[model samples]
Target: MIPHAALQTAADRFGTPLYVYDASELDAALGRVRSAFGGAQVYYAMKANPNLTLLRRMHAAGVGFECVSGGEIARAEEVGASGDRVLVNGPAKLPGEYAAGARLGATFVVDREEEVGLLPPGSRALVRVNPALAVSTHDHLATGAAGSKFGVTPAQAPGVLRALRDAGHTALGLHVHIGSAIRDAADFSAAFARLAELHPAVSDLDVLDVGGGWGVGADLPGIAREARAAASVFGAELWVEPGRYLVAQAGTLLTRVVGQKRTGRPFLLTDAGMTELLRPMLYGAEHPVTALWEGEPAGTWDVAGPACESGDLLARDVLLPAPVPGGLLAIGEAGAYGASMSSTYLTRPRPAEALWEGGEWRPIRRRETPQDVWAMEQGLE
Candidate 1:
């Protein structure tokens, strides 16, 4: 977690609606993953927070990347990641994505059976399996659940692996990613058990990737135990892909209280909105908000954003002190999808980002201007 004083300082220097990440927190999260799953290859899911500076830091620490798109693969390449260090993943991969992965010699996670034929010749791949287990996450986040469009069924996984080998591609192993932000460890154990049942039928696999969706406070060791057991059944190496787990707590969104309004319940208006952090409106994600300035207990208020939409609330019924116009408010657990998912909707300039390292604040991304937002529409020569 970023220090409250540090968050305030960042807000004062970078202006309101800023993103600040703690480098120490990032390192600590990586350390925890390494400690928990000894000898298991770890890939940082670039979709979480694809900041180039953060990517370089992870690469320097000897971590690989799990890329989902051509753009993400380019980001990984920019940070000196390629070949086995880059794992390409997606259900519907574009030709450009396949070209990018092939050019970099990256391993691809084959989502569908047809994707095996789409890859470059002799490409190394892993067959993603949908365990069809009902997970305890939002419907939008469950990728491996029944009826999800992410991966093939368990009945189809073995055939997909064989299809890859028959197509002259290197069949690495099987991959299973249940969902994101899954709080139940039992969900993972059950998924692993399902895979373990495949046994000698799916033997001789080189890798067993138990995709990462562990909640922030999840029991990693317990999950790793189950993962190791499952991998042992195939005598395959273990691999894990963690995105939100590594960065969720390291980030803070600093927004200012614009004013107060009353529409049924009291509301604290903010300069930031859905354009800055869409998780609240998109997934009903509740980020913990902390008031920076000191004040007396006022009442419970809905922290509303500048957007005109009524669903633009970042948080609701938040117990906060009296409204201090122009005061700073820090939204916590934003290090994962906050900045990466930000858009220029409603013509709102996306927030700038900074990193706290070596007792100093380092600016990572510049705040966009109105001109920057509509530059593409200016004119085409």
Candidate 2:
């Protein structure tokens, strides 16, 4: 674990409702992934957290970038990631986004047949094959399973490839993203084996892009090992687009306790809630919660945010030291989907983001203000 002092110091300097990331931790995580898959290309899924500081660090570490939209493509360029080192993936791509990606020379723009005609002349491409692999995770996150609207179904891919071939577009690879937070490596191996059967028919298969959804601390080393085992089977030049596994553990959400009350169950109200981090309230996702200060241990408490809705809970039946109003709390494993998924619900301002390194804290993003929220309203005058 990163030293808690770093988090406390960051909170002291940046204030509460802050996201603190440890650069050293990120480097170590990237190193582990590289070592496990010897010579494979690891692309940082920019959708997770697009903080420029994080993007620069990942780029400097020899990591590539994966973009799902034109905005992400621009961000990748801003951080010095060239198009040759970037792979554009998404089921939906607007004509402008596809044209922009083509103009930038993105390594490969993955297609799902829906946007095949949008491919720029003489550009290289990859067909994303939805093998209908079952992934164990939240229903909202499962993308590769049968009947999903994500990638091209196995039955649709061959036709798409043939059409692309006839159109003179270079089909250089195949891509697949099973789902998010996958726990089993066997699932990946099975999927790869199914894709391998199609390899013989694919021309000039220079890359096998495996969409990244490597599970993080919810399962720990178990999922990490599975990722490694799965990567070993695909001896081709492999590419992985992992977002959560790399940054999740390197983050913490520090929120101040607003009040303590007891109803049917003890409740700890925090100033930061669904507006700042929506994974819990939006998907009922689990994140470990703890008090920042040392104190006598207390029993179960329902940890909730300031949102008016009863569904705005971070955790329930959570054991922690009794916290006083104004006390600090840290929500662990928040680096990935936390801030990126934040919203302006209930008109609350978004939280700030910070970077922790060498005992110093640097503000990466400013906390949003009420004026910032209303600035876009045309009739606010």
Candidate 3:
């Protein structure tokens, strides 16, 4: 674990509503993936945390990138990820985005048949097959099962492959992303078996992309083991696009206590809230939070942000060391989807981002200012 003293210094210098990432922690996570997979290609799903600094660091470490939109593709390219090393996947692709990926020579474009023709000729493509297997996770995240909007059904794969083959599009891979935050190895193993069943029909295949949705929590080792074992079964040029598992535990959201209140339950109002981190309010997600300073014994407090909605609570009835006004609190497991999903809701400016390396903190992204928000609006004549 990184020392709290360094984090305190980072918060003090960069100010609250800041995101601090430990470079060493990220390296350790990548090293773990490299060691476990043994020559398999790993792609960092850019949608998880596309902070340019993080993306560039991943590229520098020899990791590939996975893009879901044209903007993400441009971001990856701006950060030095060449098109040949980028994989584009999304159920819906706008004409402009498709053209951008094709123009960039993206390594693999995972298609769901709805817009396969949108891709330019000679584009290497992969068919996203929906296993239709129900994996236990939040409904908003469960995409592999039947009726999901993510991929084509299993029965539709062979036909899609035949069409692509006849159309002369290079069908070189098969891709499937079951869901996010999965906890069981059996889920991945089963999904792989389902994909392996279709491998024989698709010819000239050189890659298999098991879309990254590996879950991370306190039980990371078990999850890694399961993911690796499942990947071994493919026995092809395997690729895993892991986002959450890579950086989720390497970050924290430091919020300052703004006030304390009691309603049906005690509420600890913090300077940081849904506007800064929305997982809890959006998906009922739970993040382990603790006081920054060592102090009085723990007590149950409903952590909430300044949003007007009643659902803006971060964690309810969570135990934390006694907090006072201006006390800092750290929200754990925030490295992946935390800041990437922040918004300017309630007209609040976005937070800045910093990277911790070599025993020092450096500002990677500057904090947003009020003018930055309205810069896009046309001024009155």
Best by lDDT: 1
Model 1's C-alpha root-mean-square deviation from the true structure amounts to 1.0
The CA-based lDDT of model 3 is what? 0.80
Q: Model 2 RMSD to the real structure?
A: 2.5
The root-mean-square deviation over C-alpha atoms between each candidate and the true structure, in angstroms, is: 1.0, 2.5, 2.0
Q: Candidate 1's residue-wise lDDT over 254-284, tens digit each?
A: 9999999887888899999899999999999
Error of 2 at 187 (Å): 1.9
Q: What lDDT score is found at residue 247 in candidate 1?
A: 95
| Cα lDDT over the full model 2 | 0.78
In angstroms, give how far residue 4 of model 1 lies from its true place: 2.3
Looking at candidate 1, the ten consecutive residues that score lowest on lDDT are 1-10
Looking at model 2, which ten-residue stretch has the lowest summed lDDT? Answer: 217-226
List TM-score per model, in order. 0.98, 0.92, 0.94
Candidates 1 and 3 compared: the better one by TM-score is: 1
Candidate 3, superposed: residue stretches over 4 Å from native: 217-235
Model 1 misses residue 243 by how many Å?
0.1
Candidate 2 lDDT over 1-381, as tens digits, reads 657777777777778888888877888878777766666688989998888889998888888898888899899888888766888878778777777777778865555675667788777777887778777787777777886777776667667877777778887667888888777766676666667666445535666777778777344344344444443444446777889888988888998899988888789998888877888876678899878878888787888888899888988888888787787889988998899988888788888998877767778999898999888895767
